[model samples]
Target: MKKTLNINIGNSIILIEEDAYEMLTGYLNEIKFHFSKNADHFEIVTDIENRIAEMFREMLLQQQKQVISIDDVQLVIAQMGSVKDFENADEAEGGIYEETISGVKKLYRDTDDAYIAGVCSGLGHYANIEAKWFRLMFLVSFFFAGSGIVVYLIMWILIPRAATRSQRMYMKGEAVNLHGFIRNFEEELAGNQLISRSRGFFVELAEAAGRIVRTLGKTFFKVVAWLIIILGSCFFLAMLVGMAVFLGFSDANPNEYFPLNIVNDAYLSSMVFAFFVALAIPIIALVLFAIRVAFNSRAINRTVSFGLLVVWLGGVMLSIFYITKVASEFKEEAEFSQVRELKKYDAYTLTLDRSRFFSRADSVKYQINSDKYRGKVILNDMDDPYNLPRNVRLNIEKSENGLVTLTQNNSSHGKTFEAALSHAQNIHYDFSQQDSLLNFSPFLQLNRNTKWRDQEVTLTLKVPVGVKLILNEEMDLFSYSFDYWSCEDHGAPKAWVMTEEGLKCTKP
Candidate 1:
């Protein structure tokens, strides 16, 4: 029977009996003696203390003794682990930053993988919680606009990363076995554990066989990866050059942006170039991989893997950055304007007549003429000529406020439509009507192989509020790319054919 003394670990309080306390004190004295000459007396002592406390608790549980006895304390001392294990298991997480650490579990700011702050993910990982829950909680706290991101950013800027080796390893999901270091070592050796498949029968066999075969194979692959890396580099560079020239040509001239012309063009060009560049690197790597397979190579080089991993990580990060930027831009703008508004105003239509705009020069008029352009207008995609865009439509709506709204829509398959929408966003294209004519302008387009937009337009012209007129388009406006027209006494025709003289006639 013994009285108890309290010890605290983190937020948890531990009860130690008088007998155990005395015994623990004796063991501590021994450790102090052994580390007497060490410079880190504080660290050594702290580690030993935590280990003593943990074992004392374990003893109380196992022996069903309310008090930790001197015998139990002696047993703990007997269980006193090697310096390495003691250091590891009982090591105070030593704070997040080595320079600023005072104790374990220091809350340091993390600035990785976040637009504002990766606080949720980082902290979740540190605390062993699901990142999703943190994100939900963070979002819930703000109620709207995800304001927790800002708080996280603040935390990131203020917190420091775990400094101690042990702390850092824990942050990265590694365990620290300070008290069991030697025991674990002995256990591993006794069990003949294959921690890394190293120095084992199979490992030795593999090492020998691989050495004889892989050296040759590795050499061959190194050569191939080198070639692919070079060739892929050249291909990507060439695509860049071509894009630059085409964009320069388009900017120097300019083209008609009807129903998002520039966006369509730019989207097409950028996507084609990007696809070529993106796939080239992967393909080149794959080629090297194939060669490696043929030659019977093992894993990729650590350096090469590490380098590629960094590059891929960078790409993902950059993509997130850009997406976040764009999403922010759209946060304040969400309105759908109808077409038909622009028909009341005098508008000009620039014809997109060139085929293969993505790969062919002068495929669009702007490329043939513009000097203010940043890139060529490339078509994002087209259905098979046989399965061409159905429910494809164009309308000019005159709003009550004298604003014209022109809308272009297509009823295509979901995937194909998504591709088209992606093209529109990538190229910076949007639709709005002003003055009299519907201004269809696009920021970009995507390249579509084997499928092309057909020559047909559907049109519905809307007159301005309280405005009416008679108009003439050279051709009946069903909806076509180029409808020549001339107008006299009339409001603009929602559907009109372009005439050399202008809108020629008017209809109800």
Candidate 2:
């Protein structure tokens, strides 16, 4: 166990063994004495001491040692080179040193030679190309979706600025030895071409624009962050209120609605909560980030942020699981048809029926007594929010057997064929005839508490040739078999005749 001493060098405290401390002191003294005759000796010596301290700290960290050993001091001295090595250089007065070792280059921003952020210059140094070529490439690439601007800003932020002489030397691929250090110091004092270069008109203009943008960009970003904070908080609050309203009003039976009706009632609440968590967490995170930018502080601790992330991921996974589960229900499809014969008539009128048909369960739920409300019909508005999509379609065709008939085709989807058939059978549609008038319902209805499975009804009216028919204007909504609007010029109560080709508009 050799004795250790704490010493202060270049404003940094370091622990070193007795022999290592003596060797480091001697080396520093030798450097100081050699540079004492120079006009800028104090500055050069200070920079060397700071570089030495930085290297020592790096050695301690990389080697995991408590105190600097004699071997560590010798290694540092060899890398920095001895004063005798500098004196023996070929051009010591001109500050031109012999290349003793090939140095590895690092990418660092050369602010002294930069127009904006020195990104191009740093890249040029690393790639051993002229900076003008990189600048021209970036300028040309800016026209392609402004990608060059994004790439340059990213590199500026990611690449460190060379603030020290040693770092600048490393960036320029110069050896970090005594000779290189003195050469760099002399060049800085005498002013190099890189610092004395004149800027072109366009380059000067660009630099001026960059400075203005940077000055205004800080204020613009603050305003944007504030706007995000306000908008995000409002959205987050609205989400909470919406989730509460949906979960609170259980009697409203929201699952009976069109889109929500697709999900199973068993996990409806769980799915809704998961969706809320998944959606709300993002808004919350955005608000927090905005707050950090606007106020320069974190709103939550690292633990809370981590917890929010976990919860958000859980919510996303749960939502995906439920979505897959619901999608599986639509794997199979089934359809069935029914045919009915109508009384013989030379001419008939087809119209949409707005009257709603109520089942016993619906009557009970609305507390309407059948006998008390006899003969009174409840008109269904076509624009009701609770109503499903218009699932009914009508087609008129020439009859093959010269008989008047109507065919109803109903279809639905489910996890299995039998289940799909059951769902299709659960659909209820209304059609009635009074003398020459035929009425068709606008939408199909499902049995009570039944989930939606893409149920649909298609009606086909087959009439004998030469038979004439008058159709209501609203009937066009259910007919896709022909260009109904084209028949509008025939006059109100559009008339059609069954021809060999099919139904044709009759003359006004």
Candidate 3:
């Protein structure tokens, strides 16, 4: 290295050996002095200096030998594309296949967007056509296959961007830059994207890795953007088709496919909002996205994607919540009333309505007890009022070991209750002959009325089996009942109703 090496050539920031810098500067000064007074001169000289400085920087780094030799500068200068040669580009005119070119020029893919992308906004750049036509095309497709969006995304990721200056100019329909203008731009591009002069391979590796990551990120984004475009197109089409279906079938009864009271205000409101959201979101995104694609921004596209995802998740969760709330309320309002005389059936079975439950019920169990022994009973929910009519269907079975079972098929979600009497011989539960030890704390608390959260139901005491019983006026359940709805003028209620051979209905 020679002494006195600090040098700034046309803002290119080249670092050269002392002797090399001196020689290069001497040449530039001589050239400037020669053209110092010429017309069409000031800009011409400045641009020359800019180009020379750019070449010198490249020469310094190419071989990486300590000194920047004059020969290296000449070699770099030779590599620069000349305006005359570019003008003679008829040689490369048809290098790309004609069919491929035509197709390439017509494709549009969604990229990142602060708004939407399915319309003219995204298509304008990719297809060389104004975004308006693309938007209209997509709108039309919305009524058909609804697949334009998906196609758009696939195209975006697959298509390479116009990287070269010439390519960009062609893409935007700009005229080729003049000789001096091209030189100025080349210098500017070099300045904007300078390479590192580090000797460490590790540093170079790290930089390479960083570049790979950035490339990967951009590719991923472009691919995702295209997919979004296709999906948006599909969504738009879906909305249109949905409306048409509704209109065309409005006069026809669709009650067979839908629930009895399914069509309502909430459904209509949701459909309307969904349509607007589908139709407007993509177009809006396309505009903001077009801005980013054509220009540049601070990763605003990622922010938009993230926001859209959040809103989508919110909609899903909100729908599930709404369904659950409505189902619960409906069950609470619906009543299951059946009060009959105890004498009506020898063995009575009470079943809880399972239609009110979702797929959360899977297992079922049952319990069998004589007056002497008792246990647990469980059941599964198979009742679906939406798909099946409201009706009770239960078949009880008792195992040899005395365990009772009640079950429904094809569910993974809930539990049900099942209880039936076995032999009255060993299992003896007499409802009428009430045991003095049995506590009525929960059964009979006058303060806890049914209307005030703990209302009572009236059940007249029945006569015990094997016992001679006389008429009891208190057995008039209708008059003595705290709540008449509990057990109307039906015969006396029982703790255990005895059957002929020996079957009793009683729960422990």
Candidate 4:
């Protein structure tokens, strides 16, 4: 049957029982009477009253109570203390006051003088240190580890704001009782000169500039995080699709031309899986962290973050080890050389046959060596021996014995020289003779069981003096230097004769 009354506390509206209101009003009047003789007595009493109002609002909000009760008023008085307690405290017992702050220190965000969320200020008060030191520590840690931003944001969310003067007093390790409370109220009323002594105009200006920079930095990091999340997600999804289509579902996939095919199928799968794990986990973690920052969500646990880091590190190590294993397969090399005797001939024609070059119906078939040289010839049908080519190059020189000799040199690479030699010997080329005419195969072929190991062939023609050699147009991009000019640059057909000096181009 108790009547309720509406009251304003620290600009907040609150409802309280009539009895509680009377008790609070009498307690505040008593405080005002005690500080009556002081110069700043009015300011001190006003501050204390405001502190009581703020406490009332906090209790109502925290307890979900509809109206403040007498019990609630008495509890707040016990926490803040009565005016008589300050009068009883002695000032001569080797201290400014015999009474000390009895309430335990509490963490609270000091909104009165805060830069961003008052986290450093709250932490400083709780730890009994200067706030600027905490700020400096955060700044240094930001440059070194980037953990400061995360920690600051987390603290901002966790620490409650010091909405009441009593809470603020407790935050600074001051007693919430009347004696210590009066001292703090008077200090605050005294214009806060102690804290503001070092804060000049330049300090305020610098703080303003820092705020602008901090805002810009936040925006920049947001954009960067979004980009990393989106791009990383797209790339990770593409890898998954590729793996599913090529490795997971396909049977007898003929796309053996892939560079990863150098390793065994199982090892390739392991490597790709490791690489995907190495890339995807960090992307996911970073995206999650970005979302937390943008939304101000709960911070990730340290244990979980550390676990993800360890997993990413393991994936990286696995990928590097497997890549090294694959590269080692091409370390050793072997070559094959053979000399074939040619019948008596006054001249010889070095030509690559292109009879069915364009007759293939499948135009989209994976054609090797599809690149052009100086915009002249597209060496599509002729493989480049530098990367497992099926084509061979020809070199001509004068013979010492006045006889014609054709020497073929083939080379290949593998994990061992014996394996390389086996691969090199597997290369097949056809060269047939008809009286004075010698025909050579345009492309070399690898045996069905043989794998590509950068296999290539070179033919050396030992021509006698006065023997003329004609290079056909099909050998345009396939041939290297024969005379002073490059045979690959042949506009039309060219003829060269072996002399005592060297092979000389017959044309101007």
Candidate 5:
């Protein structure tokens, strides 16, 4: 077994056998000694060392070799060639290099002049074109397809970065030997024919515009991120506070909001919890992302992020399921109707009596402002009488029999016919008699246990022919808006007698 030593080559760490390490060191020393006679000896030697380090790193990574052997070092040296190969070259050549091009060019990411990744730069070098051309091509494609960024990211992930002098030379289709390496380094130092050259006015202007755009784009993204964070956090916190308040206190009269009344305690709790979780996860994620953008914080762990995403998805599914479940309750509908006969009387009068209507035995002090009708309506459980919409449709017709008859059709809806009928039956309406005067309630009342299902009443009055009917001013309270003309001109009050056709105006 040979002893191995850990060494850092360029910016890469590698393991090399003791004999291999000594050979590599000796080879570098020889190159240094040869280049020592030149004015740019340091530059040439440093470039060579970086090249050797890069080669070692590649061998270790690509070949899966745990330790570099002496044979590996010898192979690298042979490929690079020795100082004797170029020792006889004329110094009077004015350091002018011949075109030592190579057809075998390797693709690499150029980190030196890269804006985001060096993929474009590497592509430019491989295609023997200017990097600006690749940049322009990518920029144009970015607007058309927005696919340039995705392709760039994929290329960045797949292509190896050009990390050393020798690899960079190979990427540019230049020879990797000592003479080429020294020539390239000298050109780079002297600013002759390096990767980037001085540009004309348009090129400089384009570069400046690119810089400004990049800066503005970065600022805009940061502002958007911050806004998302603030808005998400505020909404999330507000929802939490609402939930907290709900948990602390129960709704005073859930029947006031009939849709909520149908939702049982068990399902209501589950649906609310699922809704909160489903809504909160994305909001929290946005907040976290915003925090990261604002503070330049480290990203969350991938495992945790994936787990949160899965959990959020489950919450969303649960929320959708409960929402569908709740919505299904209104799918079916039914109504209940009944009619009652009125006792015979000589002369009948109709008037709305608000006092006797709200005089209930078990009335509570709960009032709710409801939007169940065209305008705002008040619903009071105790004293106030305008509880529900007064959708009372009425028609007066001549009765075949002499006795007057009143017909009432109360209608409502529910998930099932039976449920709907039960709710409709729960509605309480009063139209009783005091001698010949009939007292009617303007609005219908639904008890607390009965969920609202658009409950309404239709009252039909059948009056015998020759019967005198007295309709007071309170007839205006009837939802149909009865427009009978009897004002200061006829202060004595006009009486209508039920004729064969309908109610006819007659002098009282």
Candidate 6:
């Protein structure tokens, strides 16, 4: 049964017992009267009141009480120390008014000592470790994939800068009493720094401009961080979906594709997973970092970050190992050529063959109904141009003898010459002659389940003197040795004549 009164302190509404309120009022009045003669008396008193309000709020939250009791007021007074205690502290050599208060250190960016953002200096105060050691650790971490830069940026965003004298004192583990405040103020005055420096109109204007630039810079960084969070998250999700799709199709001969075909089937899965890890981990880290910067909170703990780093390194190493192993398979190259006599003709029409020559395995895989489509020629679609490298080339030359002949040169690369020759032999190319018409496949195909080893086919057609040949419009794609496009007539199929010297284009 006691009378309670509502009072305003440091812009906070506090409900206190009548006796407690009276005691708090007396204490504050004593502090104000004592500091009334000081130049920064208003600032000092405001800070003290703010500190007391914070302590009261903390006490209420911690003790689960809505109203301040006499005991709570006494505890706060003891922690903050009385005006007499502060005076004694000023007189006593190296004797702080409140040991517990002096020991209460807070984490804040010490911008005064900062090379960048004062994060190391602030951490040094909180952890009681040298800032130089933290700097060294960050510098060393930079070599490990520039992870240090991300960490430093995140810390800068999350840790608040010490802006006020009391905050600076807290950051440095100093008491925030009247004695300590006066001493700090005197030290700053003695240093003759910014506070004591005389400011002219231009200097003040320059400082104002600097402040505006700093504020704009902060705003710009926040915008960039938000953009990164949005874009990085989307990219990360896409990568995850891509990895899932790839792994889902792992059993369905994914190695038949061009680049994947370069790797051995036995270790293809491992190599793909390693590559995914190497790429995906960095995106994940970037997204997490952006989230931290945008939200001003830690997205993950140090242990999880370190673990991710280790996994990323492992993936990179594994990818390198696989890449080296795959590269060694293309060390040697082998080529073989075969000559065949062609039926003599004065004029021949050459055309590109788009029809696919499906083997028994391909027919079974495609579930083609041979009886239903007996006479139908299924045209192979060339939608995916990079499904394989350009593996076909054509050349026309004058015949050394009076007879017409065709030569096919096959080439491939592998670990050994024999292996390369075997790979070359595994290549299947289509070429056929019907009357005076010659048909050539647009691209060469690999045998079923055969790994690609840069297999290629080069065809050379030798014709006697005065023999004329007509070329299809699409045949230019396969003729690299001859300037096929340069010999093209307006909207007409190209024609050529083989003479004693070489093949000559007849534009007319």
* TM-scores, each model vs. reference: 0.24, 0.66, 0.27, 0.48, 0.45, 0.60
What's the lDDT of the predicted structure labeled candidate 1? 0.47
- Whichever of 5 and 6 has more lDDT, that candidate is 6
Off by over 4 Å in 1: 1-281, 297-300, 332-508
lDDT of 4 by residue, 1-508 (tens): 9999998866677898999999988987888788897889988877877888888878888998889999999998998877766776524223323224346788997766677667788888898889999999998989977999998866765577775666787788785665445566767866665443334555456456546667787787778777876786787688788767766754544334434445656576778778887888877787777777666674577888889899999999999998788777778999979998899778777666532232122222344333422233233444323324345777877899977998999988888999888878887766777776666677676543245677778888898899987776656545554543543344766777789998877862
* Candidates sorted on TM-score, descending: 2, 6, 4, 5, 3, 1
lDDT of 3: 0.40
Query: For each candidate, how many residue pairs have backbone atoms clashing (under 3 Å)?
Result: 87, 0, 28, 0, 0, 0
lDDT of 5 by residue, 1-508 (tens): 9999999876668799999999888888888888887899998887877888888878878888788999889989997887776475434343223334443688997766677656788999999899999999889889977998777656765677775676787788876666555755766766754455454555455446545665676688799998988899899999999776655566554334545555656677667778888989988888888888877895687888889899899989998998777666556666556666787876788876654433232334423323232243233323324345555666667889776787888877667878777777877876778878887776676675555566778888887888887777766657542346632225554477887777777766
Which sections of candidate 6 miss by over 4 Å?
1-198, 296-298, 369-376, 380-386, 499-501
Off by over 4 Å in 2: 1-111, 114-119, 135-205, 216-223, 292-301, 380-385
Worst ten-residue run, lDDT, model 2?
90-99
In the range 118-218, model 2's lDDT, one tens digit per residue, is: 88998898899999999999999999999999998767656777657767887899876665666567678657545444656655565565566665776
lDDT (C-alpha) at residue 425 in model 4 = 89
Most accurate candidate by lDDT? 2
TM-score, prediction 6: 0.60
Candidate that beats the other on lDDT, 3 or 6, i.e. the better one: 6
Per-residue accuracy of model 1 over 1-508 as CA lDDT, tens digit each: 4578885733346776776676666666767776776799878688767777677677778878666566776676667754556567546454235333333343432333332334566677777776678778887978768687567544544454443444454455654445244445656665785443223454345335434554666577677776765676677677767667755676532223222222234354444444444444465566557556555674477788667656655655554554454334333311222344344434443222212223332345224544443354435333222222322344434444555344443211112444433433322222443343333322123233212222222344443444433222322323433333333334444333334333333344
- Worst 10-residue lDDT window for candidate 3 reads 416-425
- The alpha-carbon deviation from the true structure for residue 38 of candidate 2, after best TM-score superposition, in angstroms, is 43
Q: Which RMSD does model 2 reach against the true structure?
A: 13.6
Give the better candidate number (3 or 6) by TM-score: 6
